[model samples]
Target: MKALPSSSGSSGEKEASSSLVIALGSSLGATCPSEPPMKARRSLEPVLLAPWGSCLLALGAPASRPTRKSDSFLWPFGMTTALNRGCWHKSLAMMATAIKLAVRALVEVEVRRKSERLALSEAVAELGIRDVRAIGLAHRLVLETLKRLNLLDEVAKAALAGEGSLEDLGARARAFLRLFAYRAVVEGASRRELASFVLSAREALGKGTLRPIERALGRCTTLSLDDVLASRSGDERLALELCVPTWLLRLLCRDLGRQVAIGLLKASLVQAPSYVRVNTLRGEEGEILASLEQEGIVLEPVEGLRHVYKVVEAGKPIILTDAYKEGLVYPQDKASCLAVEVANPRPGQVVLDVCAAPGAKTTYMAQLMGNRGLIISIDFSRRRLGAWRKLVARMGVKVAFPILADARFQLPTRLRADVVLLDLPCTSTGAFAKTPSAKWRLGPRSPKNMAKVQARILRASAEHVKPGGVLIYTTCSLLVEENERVVEDFLRANPDFELERPEPFLGLPGLRGLSKAQRLYPHIHECDGYFIAKLRRES
Candidate 1:
């Protein structure tokens, strides 16, 4: 919904940046295929990714990354100066290998035009780097770097005065600089430590012919984040501190109040807890818990919901374990589980899932329905729907049938359903912690533009809700334009629909007196920022 951010490249360079964004959803993955990929590009444009399944996947979910207790994950604001088990590796051999390969991986990642996302963990896993820690180290390096990218660029541009601009550099050079900035600013690496990592870039950036890169690296070491902040105040300082765009941060401060907005932004930097719902379709709840416990996944039951639990820690990456393969557990955020609970579909009912893909909510809905109801899942991308179908099949969902259709226009069928779930695409403002790249991908007008798309989808979806049936509208966004405003526009046009209280309301009341709608914040709820409203067709 937002245009990709890039330097003022040539027409060709602009197209290439746009192309890579369309081809790949994240540096690790791609969502939709809106444009063809070109082999070279320095900038990236993010497409409308299927946010259902990989809600946390894009954020990260390889067990090797290691997290903290209570799903209140304590990811460091910046990595440590030297080697630690979690940050850079102590072994020079491993650090050199990780740095060399990571730089190459990042450069290639910029130009790749894949149809689906390749998780950084998975990408590193494929690099023939035989060591497990090396792969994990590379993923952390890239992931944290991308999260702080905006701030990195701000500091970089200033440090680059008279040295040349990041936009003017080649893709490899730009990628290396971003990596170097992450180490310097985020990790607070020393001159000696920075030098160690810089040496590895020679192998990735033209094999010892990187005089320009080396010269720039010298400037990067002298840059201090504090020095960068000294000249700014208000949201300007907070923007760099949080590594979010000043525009978005300004909007949040205005809407949520400065302190509340700052708290939310700060929480996003710390990875939220990974949550999973026990698939009752595969086995009884007790048996599934026992199985997960046997596999060393320590889970704490989340209050106010059934079947959803916070994954405190896991012995191994949950996906790699038999439980996931067997579809006994689903990796989901607790806030996502809350949206599904509010929908509360029943057995034998006909449900329409608009923009459903990658099948997180569809599968969960089927699990609650006892696989007895019919769910017609509609999504724009055939690729995403195919993914949904496969996921449902794995999760033992027999009632879901996928249909390829866009929700922005009229439907292809005349069927009205007992429930209509429109978890349509939005700015993904709420899930920024999970996918930090999204923060930079958006523009000032992005939310207002996305609200238009959400409004259209909501109008079309409401038509399919039978009289007295419920239409559950939800988005992983905090912006009112995409949530409350869209709902307000729909309610004004369609007088028959009225907001109803969502059950087990765990979040704060929605703004503008839409108390029937609930809002969840990462700072307060320890979950993704999300909005949920269940509307009843009152005719």
Candidate 2:
């Protein structure tokens, strides 16, 4: 068989060359269809049942034996069939193109938003991307770019030094350049792949749109991220190297000490461990574990926490398994589970969950209560509360009621509770590994501003706690302003609440004499940076 042409004179030519190389690499030496190549190609066009399958086979390649996994290439578009060699290569090309376009669109929109932002889930849904694999890949690329934004910008600035600042580029151009830089520097994509990516981007974004950084993209391939960082000094160098803002670094250093802060920052750059809590209301832990093991999902019980396990390995996404569909388990972090355990809602008790949405804590509380308690889950967003309702139903939680109201304001009704849970919103520095975009969205004033809100909510929610009842405060944030300071201010003003050690304590003591509270760091705990304080209201 003749090899595909390799000369790249236009965007289409480059794309063809790239696709041919991918086909030659992945499909050439593995297996070939038993049928003749021509006959197989003709059959695949109609039989493959995917919009891109025929286009892929039409590009011309040898036939190969089909497999179930290969068929999943068309799964996103409602096609499920074994693909011949030619269609497989074309599927790769089409999926790659789709991912590139999706990433470009998402990054452009985010960059244009300035300080305001859209959640990645919202962006993915808005794009209406039907391919699961494409959605996953595009989401990964978007996060990688955002997580390493500072480093990517530094590299772009160095490569395009005399050209112009990244801020000066058009939104589309900036997005493309950042994506290219991440692929080139971080992913180490081949020169050929990089060239193909750039050409495809030009075609999609318009030739004139990418004109400004065309030369810079070429220069980015030659630059080294380490060399860029070595040129800076102190926190600035650390910030650029870790792809975090200098202000955030300084904040961590000042609050947690330079050594501890550096460790936390470095840990935050990597992926956090996945954990799931077995739904005791649905089944026993032993039974659930046996069922999950039958499905090839391995989990190890987290030390000190009942019903929570760290995912050792699952052949696929844990959420897709039958056990998950049956609501035998809920995907949650160990640190988060620790907070609910500290709250320790008892059967027949009245519990108020403030700012509870998506109901991870609320459902867990219901489980601990044996579904025999009155639990009111409150949040400011009606949309999020709707999701909370679904979660409640899915988890077999019958004792929880969803309320749409801000916890920072007065309660909707005069309903004091035996236990009040306040998981307030803050800078979310502790969860950077899981939600990297939050790091970029935050500014120096964010912690201070968020502290005020936390304090207000803490005060208002405290009213819902009956005298002598427990009030648990939690945040997925490491900042002292949001964690200890707010609690301290509330304690000083209220005078009726006294800090108490959270039972089944697992994390280290809180900062600045708030030793009774528990604090979890990503590096230290192998979980999200979290803070939990249990206080009892005194009459």
lDDT of 1 by residue, 1-539 (tens): 21111222111111112222211222112111111121122211111022312312322322233343323222222223222244432344566666655665565545652111233433444565555444445555655666677777876776576678778877767777788777665556544355445544543445443545554555555656766677889877778888799999989877778898888887776546677889999999999899889988889999999999987766655665688778898777888889888999999999999877767889999998999979999877654555676678889999999877767889888989999998767777887766665676578998898888888888888888999899999888898888888889889888999999999799999998899999999989989998999999985
For residues 1-539, could you state the per-residue lDDT of candidate 2 as single tens digits? 00011222101101112222212211221121111111101111111122222322332322243554433232222323246434654555554555454455456446543211233344434555445444444544554567677888887887686878878887777877887777666655544345445444544566687778766765676666665676799878878776789988888899999898988877766556778899989998899999999998889999999899998776655666788778898778899899999999999999999878768899999999999979998877655566677778888999999887766678797998999998887777887765666787678898898888788888888888999899999998888998898889889888889999998899999999999999999999999999999999986
Off by over 4 Å in 1: 1-135, 190-195, 208-210
lDDT of each: 0.68, 0.69
Q: Which pairs in model 1 have colliding backbones?
A: 24-30, 25-29, 25-30, 26-29, 28-118, 29-117, 30-117, 71-273
How close is each model in CA RMSD to the real structure? 11.7, 12.8
**What value does the lDDT take at residue 175 in candidate 2?**
76
Off by over 4 Å in 2: 1-84, 91-105, 108-119, 199-209
| Clashing residue pairs, backbone N/CA/C < 3 A, model 2 | 33-64
TM-score of model number 1:
0.80
Q: Candidate 2 deviates by what RMSD?
A: 12.8
lDDT, candidate 2, residue 458?
87
